[model samples]
Target: MNIIETSQLTKYYGKNRGIINVNLKITEGEVFGFIGPNGAGKSTTIRTLLNFIHPTSGIAKIFGMDCTKESESIKKEIGYLPAEINYYDDMTVSDLLEYSSKFYEGDFDARTKELCNIFEVEKNKKIEELSSGNKKKTALVQALLHRPKLLILDEPTNGLDPLMQQKFFEVLKNENKNGTTIFFSSHILSEVQKMCSKVAIIREGKILKIETIDNLRASNYKKVTVEFDSAEMADEYKAEGMTSKKTRGSQAYFLYRGPVEKLVASLYRVKIKNLNIQEPELEEIFMHYYAKEEE
Candidate 1:
């Protein structure tokens, strides 16, 4: 069963469009990445999914549970970490977690202690005393202690140190292996590429594309750059959909589908030193969507 599904899920704020016709589906036990540039409505879509705000039109379902009607029940089985977390500064870490546990009916003491130990969080310290990263970790502990079936994270690694971030990813990986569905939102392509199997690219409050990472790469999309032996051979190559072409001595660079036969054939006569194939960065691919979307 699809763990989450949305069809034309749209939302608006006053006259400002938040998201429009956002069609997204996340399969069970899969990590889906929500990618978009800043102010592109990533958070709005998430809020609509969580029913924190009602949609302007369209539908959303979490594990077949209606987003509008069953949000209370839906939240019980979902762990969510928003981009920003605020806490009562006077409360100790232990008190803060204990207080938040009242929302969900669960025995989180064991899990809470374990998480604190693993994350190296100080239980006795007041919330005001912790570093920004530590405070963020406290929020994470609350979100995960419920042991929900689905996890929704927005920019989860923002306040985390590199070491803690890696450790946290390991925890998420373990959760995924245990059959949890994860929907992670972030603009960091490298981490999304590493952690998510499927992804949706959104821009200007609209979803531009959704596909498996493998399928995206298999679209015969590549960047080909060739280096030539003779300085004069650089002029022989041509490119298609070629955004840029540069020549330096015998070395030439072009951005297009690889195995540039026409360009290579022209350079074959003089000196062909080496050829390099560079994969398009996710941001570049995302920009392609943006350009198409704008048009």
Candidate 2:
């Protein structure tokens, strides 16, 4: 079953635009990444799907129920973590999660305790007393405690430490392995590249690209830099149909989009003293996309 379906799903803020003509479908059990920079309308799209705000036009459906028409029902199966969170400051972490559990209609004690242990959150601390990372961890536990079918995580790793972030991803991966559909929004490109099987790159409220991880890997472009014995040997680093060269010190470097072996052979021809290979990160690829779009 399609876990989420949106067609021309548009949202506006008075005269301001949010997302326009967004058509997307998410399949069951897919760990999908919604990749974009800050203020590219990623949050706006998430809010519309959660029915926290109404769309100016178009439609959004989750589990076959229209977001605007049946948000109450659809929310029952959704586990959402907002990019920003605010709660009763006076409440203890234990009290806060316990209070939230009331809305999900289940005894979340076991899950809550287990999550607290895993996330290293102190249940005795007041919500206001906790650090940002701790508060974020609390929200994650609350979102998962209900065992919802779909996990809609918006900037879910916002306040985690490096160790905690790894732990959270591990937990999410396990969830996906067990049939939970994950639609995560993130500015962390490396995280998305590592975790998501499928990714959609959105910018200026438009989804510019969507592809499987394997496809993106295949499309990976490497920047091959070789330090030759002398600048006189720099020409040997050049390959057919390859352009864009930069020289610093004794190194002749150029970008490579073909097999790694070709670049290695070209370097060997130059009697390279040393070599460096840098792969284009998703952030680099995304910047290339937007930069070209503007042109």
Candidate 3:
């Protein structure tokens, strides 16, 4: 089942573009990654879906319910973590969590306690006294307390330490295993690469690509570096898929996306000293898409 669907969903903030012609269909029990650079409209899309903001045109639905009309009902099944979190500063962590639980109908006390323990959050500390990391942990605890069917996370790991980040991902994985759908939005490509099965890359308020992690990795681009006996030998070499070529004395390095055999044959024409070839990182692959879009 598609737990979330949007078609040509456009949003504009005054004269500035937020997102245009955006479409996504995320299935149940999947961890979908929404990735982009800063100011790429990742937050805009999430806010629109949650009905925190209105769309200019098109449709958005969660569990087949209209986003604007049924948001209250839809929210009952969603656990959301915004990019930035704010709360009453004077309240103790225990008091804040207790207050948050009153909005939901479930008995989340046990789960809340478990989450606080896992995150190492001090219950007695006032919100004003907690560190940024602790505040984030408190926010995460609230979001997961209800055990909602869907999780909408925007830059969720911003204040987390590396160890905490790993632990959080482990928790998310367990939630997915239990059939909770997750929409993970972040600029951190490596984390998305590690956590998501499928990813949507957005830029300048538009989605440029939606691809599986495996297919994205198999996108043919190869990082190739070759060392020659002389700059003269390096200057004479050229082959298909060689782009952004650079030379540093006796070394020539470039990105390739064509047949390896052809690249090898071209190397035979040069007096080679050493050679290295490896897969391009997700960042490089993302830039390739942006380059293609610019073209």
Task: Please give the range of 10 consecutive residues that has the lowest summed lDDT in model 1.
Answer: 258-267
| Global local distance difference test of model 1 | 0.85
Compute the lDDT for candidate 3: 0.90
lDDT of 3 by residue, 188-265 (tens): 877888899999999889999999988876675788999999997777678877887999988999998877988999
lDDT of 1 by residue, 72-133 (tens): 99998999998988889889999989987888996888998888887888989999888889
Error of 3 at 192 (Å): 0.8
Q: What is the C-alpha lDDT of each candidate?
A: 0.85, 0.85, 0.90
> How much does candidate 1 score in TM-score?
0.82
In every candidate, how many clashes are there?
1, 0, 0
Instruction: Give lDDT tens digits, candidate 2, residues 167-232.
Output: 999999898888999998998777887789998888888888888978877766777777788876
Better of 2 and 3 by lDDT: 3
Candidate 1 — which residues are off by over 4 angstroms? 219-243, 247-283, 290-295
| lDDT sort, best first | 3, 2, 1
